[model samples]
Target: MMTAASSSGTAPFGLSVLDNALTGIGTSASEAYREVIALAQLADRRGFQRYWMSEHHAMPGASTSSPQMMLARLTGETQRIRLGAGGIMLPNHSPLLIAEQFGMLSALAPGRIDLGVGRAPGTDQATAAALRRRHDHDDRFPEQIGELVGFLEDDFPEGHPYRAVHAVPGPWQAEQNRVPHTEGLPELWTLGSSTYSAHLAARLGRPYAFALQFGRADVTSALRIYRDAFRPSPALAKPRVMVSVSVAAHDDPEEARRQTSSTAMAMLRMFQRKPYALLSPEEVAAYPATLDERRVLDMYMANTLHGTGSEVGVALERLHEQTSADEIMLVTGGHSREIQTSSVELVADHFGLPVGA
Candidate 1:
């Protein structure tokens, strides 16, 4: 049987910003940022609680090179939905800088901001080196994460000399009073694709969000670890978990697949470094494929929850029932603008969720 919290109700569903992966369909980054803006607006209307952007640097496939800048931009465009990074790769910068940047964002957006952290570079090795200068080491992540948590919290205790330092400027200018350095500090979630993250999040008494879109095999194991090791915090009296799933919304399965082709191809190319393009309906119909490509296609199609509007609804409810996820964080790779805008609305309506006017 699922845990009590899992069976009680469907938790708030949210969105993850993959940016250009939706706009270019396979082409470029120029339109991707705009597509993200549009999705953020739609998600707010659709009652999705939060929108997260993953920190991916120098990855030609993703447009979110800077989640903080995107968060600030979204805060101006969106009114209610929480804005945060799916994760900030912790080892890339000092804990103090992250504290200040997020602190400033929380100050600006108030109650609608969140901070989800992860240890991986969120990119390739070369890309990590470009971001971290000489400290391109993998083992430093755990230490960096500890320091990051320390920098965000105010009371560092008397013996912790490092706590005396203010991450954001001075006391007079810090405006700790205005920023609720304590209360205004956004809700924190640990994004993990494995059991290690689940254990850490549980030990830390914070929520854990699974990146199931890529780590499909490890989802169950990770969830089990989190539940077993969970310790309650003031923020959470019980363990809270979120699963990230791929979504492709449409009334027809064939139509949805056609719409998702370039997206699938783009993801494949990200791994294979092959050339791809945004295919037209006829092109999608005419597109050729190899057995290996077809296998990749099968994996993508199986993992993604896509189909007719009602079909998606049933699948989402089932996913929630089986996993008891506190929230469903939907990640869609829209090959065009139309899908980008309509998909979230389609999901919301099918679930009987209110779309704000």
Candidate 2:
């Protein structure tokens, strides 16, 4: 369950950020990382509920391959905004290691850490093979989630084979040593773009985050399934839903649309199995796309909310009404730092989010 501290200020629904740390055609990966810090600080001061980063592997365009490392850096950069993995692709790593990493994060910023896990590989099949090295654990996602939760909670059944294994610097460690520590653990959330994840989250009674930005799943139906099938657990008493949407907003509507074109083209290239590199608006404008590619670009743009800040705000409100989501997370489109920062500020202002909080 979300605490008042984490959910405050945004009254009707919480507003948060999900960053991919995308590098533009001319930008370096280091610069992209620095921008991420700046954005986190800006979001922290502007009162966004949470600042989360996604994990992707072998994507030259996306620099956030290790969300844990970035979040560790954020523990000192921001004072209030919650820091989290928008999601960690769990099949690529050990559940025990993730437990330890997040446990350390909890120690660094108690009551301000979120661990959202997904079943996807977050990479191509070849890269997934390279990461797991013949494990092929995608089908074992549910069991891995269970093992992760058990490690975090330190409550594995006595007969379990791994019952003796404990994640150090975790709850179990603190209790065993009677060490004085902070009062909270990393809040676990389930991330998905389908009803399967919704059902799993419901059965486990964890918060659910639907990735509407993926544009491949029905958000409304998945959220409904989650709510209808929810069963309370010790971690959460009722269903909590967060919907993430792609957005590009600015004071000037045309600039907003232009900003979205870069990401739209990037999505188009991704569909073509080409390198998913974010191009500048100028480059996107000069590209000669085929009819089929144009269709894909148009479809991508149609799914993204783009316009003036007020227009985007209204669209988000409509989405909230449609999905009855407890939180709305913005995955800002485009790779321009100025546009990204401006969109967040403008939308924050439109929503009347308190500043300097």
Best of the candidates, lDDT: 2
Residue pairs with colliding backbones in model 1 are none
- What's the C-alpha lDDT at position 4 in model 1? 16
lDDT tens readout by residue for model 2, 1-357 = 221122224337888999888888888989988999999999898888899999998877788899999999999999988999989999888999999999999989988999999988887778888886346586789999999998988889999998999987787788888976564679899999999999999999999999998865799789989999999999999999999999999999989888899899888887777777889888988999899988988888888899988898888888887998899999976868678888888888788866664
**What stretches of model 1 exceed 4 Å from their correct place?**
1-21, 25-28, 133-137, 159-161, 169-183, 273-288
Question: Candidate 2: lDDT of 319?
Answer: 89
TM-score of each: 0.86, 0.95
In model 1, the Cα lDDT at residue 35 comes to: 72
Candidate 2 regions exceeding 4 Å error are: 1-11, 133-135, 180-183
lDDT of prediction 2? 0.87
Give the number of the best model, judged by TM-score.
Answer: 2
